[model samples]
Target: MGKIVVSENVSLDGVGQDPTGEEGLRFGGWFGQVGDSDREEWAKVGFAEALGAEALLLGRRSHEWFAARWPSRTGEWADRLNGMPKYVVSSTLADPGWNNSTVLRDDVVSEVRKLKRRVNGKIVVYASGRLVRTLLAHDLVDELRLMIYPFVLGAGDRLFDGIGDRKPLRLVGSRTVGDSLALLTYQPIRDAGA
Candidate 1:
């Protein structure tokens, strides 16, 4: 069975929105606040994750965002990301412009379940906050890999917003990436009685 891993870059205050300043939010571009060394280390971590993942699960906006940038880049990481199977959960998206992309127009939960069954390795999710919340609500996520940046965006959409219930997780790994970033890996405690 495929393990659904939600990998994200979040702020110290749990903000995950507009990290790249693409959305033009007030606190956007928090990702650029860090130094070059920090960013370099973060990129290495991302590359390693992409190398390990069997497939990518994304939302429509993220699909569009990545398709605009990654397709033109030529490198090992870019090649892997562009060639990997990508499933975008989008009802309105007619054509996923990215290579090896599929649009999931049906119920999100059921579609993800089917994907989990079909895929053999890790299905990594990136930059899809709404979809991530849905997966968390339904207990579909097997693990969370959060790269926590040092900045605290006092007002913005957070990573854990709108998650109605208490979803418990156990920290499986923790490390610092460069000088300011914290990489945390957590596994969801699925068994309520455990």
Candidate 2:
């Protein structure tokens, strides 16, 4: 079985919004706040994560965004992402428009549970703030990989907000990427008698 991995680029204050700077949020372009030296390192991390995934789990908006962009990109990372099976969690999206894409129109959590039973690798969820929160709230995420940026955008969308339940995560690993960004991996600490 595979684990549900919630991976995202977050700011110091846990904001996961507009990392690509194209989301049209007020704090769009926050990812560019990082220096140029980290670009290669960031790409390496993204590539490794994408290639390691069994498939992708994304929200409708993110699915559309990636569908519009990644196909035109030419690189190992792009190829991997373009080829991977993408399971989009949405009730309203009829056609995902991305190759090898499927829409989960039923219960998202239950469908993800089935996906976990079916796969033998990782189900990586990236940049879907709403989907991430839903997974976290339901205690469905097994791993949380955060690429922490250097600054705090106090007024943008946050990755860890509005999750009404408590989900304890234990730090599994930590490293510095390019002298500025911090890569943190955490695993959920399961409680007995669930």
Candidate 3:
């Protein structure tokens, strides 16, 4: 079975929305405020995660967002992202334009469960907030890694919002990436006797 790893760049206040500013969100583009050195170092962290993953699982919006940008870029990170097998979770996506892509349009829980059984290594979800919440609700994610930035966006949509149940996390690892971000790795601690 494959492990579902959720990797995201989030602010100190837990805001995870529109870091890139492409979505026209109110707090969008906050991610770019960091210095070049910080950004450069964070890229290494992101690249390492991509290199370690066997595939990518994304929400429709995220899939579309990535499809629009990564294909035009050229680099080791872009190469890995563009080449990996991608699973896009959407009910309306008739065709996934990216190569090696599959669309999961119904019963995400069941389809993703099957996908995990078939995959060989890590299946990662990157900054797909809606998808991440769904995975967490269903107890689908095996690992959660957050690169927490120093600044806080008080009003933006958060990464862990709308979770109906409280899930405890087991901290596995942590480190400071560059000057402003903290990389934290966790695993959901299943309920007792569950």
Candidate 4:
């Protein structure tokens, strides 16, 4: 089985929303406001993961957003994401224009579970906050890779807002990057009952 890892950039106070006051409390470009060093460092990690994955999983909103942005970025990372298989979870979006994209219109959890069984490599989920919450709730995420920045935006979309229950995770890795962001890697704790 493959892993579903959420790679997101969040503020110190846990806000992951828009900090520029454009989309109300939505964190549309929260990470972009960070310093270049911090941004690049995260990009390095996230892009590496994206390249290593067999496919990219995204929600409808994130699919539209990344489809517009990542395809324009000319780099090895961009090529990987643009060329790799992408599975999008949506009820509305009938078609997506990002190179190798597929819409998953069936039951979310069941579909993801089936995908997990078939993937031979990683499944990276990027910047899908609402989808992240749903995956967490359904035990769909095998791991969570969070790039925690140092600054806190008193208010914005948080990373863990609608999580249903407290899921146990084991920290597999942690590193501080250029005194700005902390890279935290965690895998869900397998329950004894399971």
lDDT of 4 by residue, 80-179 (tens): 8889999999988877989899999998889899989988778998877888899999988988988887776677668899797898888999998655
Worst 10 residues of 1 by lDDT: 185-194
How does candidate 4 fare on TM-score? 0.90
**Candidate 4: worst 10 consecutive residues by lDDT?**
19-28
Global fold similarity of model 1 (TM-score): 0.98
Q: Candidate 4 — which pairs collide?
A: 17-27, 18-26, 18-27
Compared with the true structure, what per-residue lDDT tens digits does model 2 show for residues 1-194?
Answer: 98899889999999988887886887778788788878779888889998889999999998999999999999889899999999999999988998999999899889989989988899999888999998998888999999999987888878888998778878999999987999999998897433
Off by over 4 Å in 3: none
TM-score, per-candidate, Cα-based: 0.98, 0.95, 0.96, 0.90
Q: Candidate 3, residues 47-137: lDDT per residue as tens digits?
A: 9989999999999999998998999999999999999999999999998999889999889999899999999999999878999999999
> Candidate 2, which ten residues in sequence have the lowest lDDT sum?
185-194
Question: Which regions of candidate 1 are displaced past 4 Å?
Answer: none
Indicate which candidate wins on lDDT.
1
What lDDT score goes with residue 172 in model 2?
Answer: 96
True-vs-predicted CA distance for residue 141, candidate 1, Å: 0.2
Q: What is the model-wide C-alpha lDDT for candidate 4?
A: 0.82
Lowest-sum lDDT 10-residue window in model 3: 185-194
Model 2: residues >4 Å from true position, as ranges?
A: 192-194
- Model 1, span 98-145: residue lDDT tens: 889999999999999999999999999998999999999999999999
Error of 4 at 69 (Å): 1.4
Provide the lDDT at 179 for model 4.
51
